[model samples]
Target: MGSSEFQSPRVIKAAGLPYFTPANNGGAALNPEDPSTPTLFRPLTIRDVTLKNRIMVAPMCTYSTNPDPSSPAIGALNDFHIAHLGHLASKGVGLVIIEATAVQPNGRISPNDSGLWQEGTDSEQFKGLQRVVNFIHSQGAKAGIQLGHAGRKASAVAPWLSWEGKKGSIRADESVGGWPSNVVGPAGGEEQKWAPGNVKYWAPRELSTSEVEEIVQAFARSAKLAVQAGVDVIEIHGAHGYLVHQFLSPVTNHRTDKYGGSFKNRIRIVQEITATIRAVIPDGTPLFLRISATEWLEGNPVAEKTGSWTMDSSTELAKLLPEFGVDFLDVSSGGNHRDQKVEPHGNYQIDLAGQLRKVIQQAGQKTLVGAVGLITEAEAAGQIVQGADEAVATEELLAGQEPKADAVLLARQFLREPEWVLTAARKLNVPISLPVQFARGLL
Candidate 1:
């Protein structure tokens, strides 16, 4: 295969033509008049990693592991993960990030979440993940993993199981190999059930200061394990009401210790985790941090009184992340507070990403931003990923406007269409790499 515009020499290269070909390659590069290519199909480089396109598959927990605690195979990857992630990579996605994996057993959102903390590279967790990462690399797509601790939301039943009959935050108690007694967070009590009534979530125990430090180490440890598994990137899952976000939001972190109170205190855990992970991973490896950006608690009477994690807070933190060695900020929102009022609609979080992107650009920071949420359809994605000059040259629109994000991430959309990149290339009238075996199908 010829050199890929998106491929970095540092990471492993797959044989055959690049899976997600760039329009700038020889065929299109020869035509100076051919400028119809969309930015969504363009490559994005962060540190040593370069993606073939701006479409990233957002981390979505599959909860496909064995639920039985007594089973040694619990919290390990298997055939399902390979088929799940491999199918996406083969279809031309530039980056395929694995789901929210736990840093420790107790940190899993469900009893079936994949986990790190195994002894060595020879461990089942390491071998399983390596197999999955190898497949992603073989398909010419960069692979990433989100290391997270579910915190107060731990030990819940999978969404599908809950939808069948149970509702709310249903727990997977001891009867099902889950440790309900171990459910913990920044502040502990019955009042902090996430959902107040009829929810199966147990009252969480507040993590002691020492326990908090240990969790930070767990993130770093998990990152080290990921590096060994040949993952191209490591993302700290600080978003959605997880452990790190639990500390970031004042609504949940009522701790009187050094970890709570002021903004600096509240952000301590995330800062520490970032520093530690950077210390462990190779310098060339990019570290991406996913953030809620906002808890969506604006204008609520309860939020007004108790204070909430708002856009202002996110902006303040975004500026400091680059200094902590974060190369990219994956902007997402909500899932922190129950009273958080959000009217989900088209481009609901795009504006927030745009606001945050402007702030980052104004500050002259190097951190790249990614927008994720209801971003379906190829044309809309192309516009969001650095607006097309020809498509938006009119004065009626924000003429010469910068894009809302450097890239657009999708969860449900990718789940619906694994070949989204190929479909997008076709829609935009651009050429992309197709699997050699599947070339006949396209013809």
Candidate 2:
């Protein structure tokens, strides 16, 4: 325990690119111009913020926030978040997006989910997020947060609660600090419950057209707060069977009002949310939207009768996002319906991203695309960013094989390997920087 047994501490400068918007002294890459470098390691500039690399840590909820009835800090990030995200940033991840944080209390998927509902920069929610953002910045990685509303999916038990033999939505009326009766969806009814035959979920109430507008405002308000917290990027959670996804999918959205019916009407809420967030946040800050490209209801008889959300629908929406002030599209799929039949394989979601990218390229939009889902391998990640696959045989898509996506987002993989970026660089045989304290471990 003597001082002689300890090594001298060295100051670690931020490790990032020089072109970052509102530039800082973050460290630059050792060799950005090396043609042999993998595309995953290249820098990408979206609006004013420039990411040092394409490897992004996708937002995966830890469900570690304090949701106790006696605690005023419920839904605020804490020490666990700081250590978790900070550790990843320090290891050289380009961006670390916080979990799907609820914009309003009722929007939370579980009582324990993170939230940004409280107002003012002085609030615990704001202060906690600001602390996390500061650490992410100090480590030279851009911080991002996914703002979402779970809708009918709200008030559910955390998956880990399975150890207690609990499953699905909480129907015990605030027994665990959840509001089972207040759960709302695009359509209301017992028949519309998420899981067709499960008695665990409460029957949802249909949100009034006016209430839908309020939810849109909540999204904008939360986005404004995120900007205040110094988030470099904001992604609207429009995918994964959340509130927005409920409205997007015809199977779930059965409203007769302006917020429902035809394609334009169904997407109306998303359009408003995107434009509102853009208006509230600084123009320099980039906005991203995550969407379920398809409901994967290809042969379902119910889907055939009701019509389903498909890649074609997503393509149309993707083309309009650039015009709606969205800077990026994070493509994911299959969480809206129980009938969604999908057998996921490696890079299963990248193909949908490719379809959207092609449309964006043909239209000459500058919007970037990010692919997610089952992308766990370093070489496959490299090929996606590099467009290493063969060209498409379709004549309309013959404008050279565009990269499958501009970036790759991995969620679970990063949890399993906090230093994934470092490991990936080693695997690809490319040189990368390590923190001076850990430099001795570099082989």
Candidate 3:
């Protein structure tokens, strides 16, 4: 279908339910005196795609895909992905970023993780992904897909199946339906053990220089395919101890080559991939890079000596991301190491996002920062977007002053409430477009 076809009245009606005005439409001006005009409902424009609201569905792995034991073409989207993502799209979300999709076969987090490397528009998998993007566009929500390689974290059984034998322990499944033993990372010959249950963990072989280059190309190729699949945004999964994060973090990257050791070297891989993908995708297509703002291993007495990834390094990286053409930074925390400490507080990683945002702004770059982690309440979500009290708290924690991120990404909360965006709109009393079928129900 042509690009103009997506704008047809029928498509628009099917995609965006009636009773909802396009948030970008020059509608009536919101009254300042109206408490319903919450900041969360304000539109956000990154490049050519403008989000109808500040709320974005963060990429959360579902491990639901078609896995072929004989084919590398496994990891194609099945009915689960379409129904799962399609449902979220119809809920009036501003943006919906699909979960971590592997760029290559071995890059998958499990045997069932979605992949786009081998799928094209002609393939069934590509069609499924395109169907998802169509559904999202129909709902007037910007669609995004996160491209990632799990690195050393790959080749593990799905989390649900992992609990069959051990609690919180991810064991390798050598069964016919399991992943192949081809996990690779920055460090080779050094075996890292898993905690939680003290399970023996075999280390991944270090990626050779040639292999590294191929991986970068793989990311570019996957991004190109994603764009062809109708994705409006491309998020590089550089966070949560993924392949790119492995290269960024000092704890995992101990290579003597140009891809490791110093800060510049550690970030080289991600920078290259970002640049490559930026070149491959169409101009104005927003590019987002998710980063583990802090590994959360620093400062702790048990972790202080490990010389782990820290906010300082992340700040430095955030400053250079714009140079590589990154439009947004999705700031997240931890997942680089098993022993990392996490405080069970709401908006736990907002401080890190605030810090990264400050650094990016101070560098005089246009790159937007997105805060995520435990942000569940509507009032708090509004405050973060408004850069008000809630934003002040995150800023104060980071630099004792300054504003917060430009946007916020919500994960588990969206899983808990697929209609959270609609719910938030109602709670904030903001005028939001809803499905015509549910319009009376809201009344």
lDDT of 1 by residue, 311-355 (tens): 999999999988899988899999987878889877889888888
**Which one wins by TM-score: 1 or 3?**
1
- Clashing pairs for model 1 are none
**Model number with the top lDDT:** 2
Error of 1 at 106 (Å): 0.7
Residues 227-266 of candidate 2: C-alpha lDDT, one tens digit per residue: 9998999999999899999999888999999999999999
Give a tens-digit lDDT track for model 3, residues 13-112: 3533333333221111145224446556766778888876777889989888766656644777766876887677777677889999999888888877
lDDT of 3 at 410: 87
Regions of candidate 1 where Cα sits further than 4 Å from its true position: 1-35, 387-398
Question: Quick one: RMSD of model 1?
Answer: 5.3
Off by over 4 Å in 3: 1-12, 15-36, 71-73, 193-201, 299-306, 387-402
Candidate 3, overall lDDT?
0.76
Candidate 1 structure lDDT:
0.82
TM-score of each model, in listed order: 0.90, 0.90, 0.87
Which stretch of 10 consecutive residues in model 1 shows the poorest summed lDDT? 23-32
lDDT of each: 0.82, 0.83, 0.76
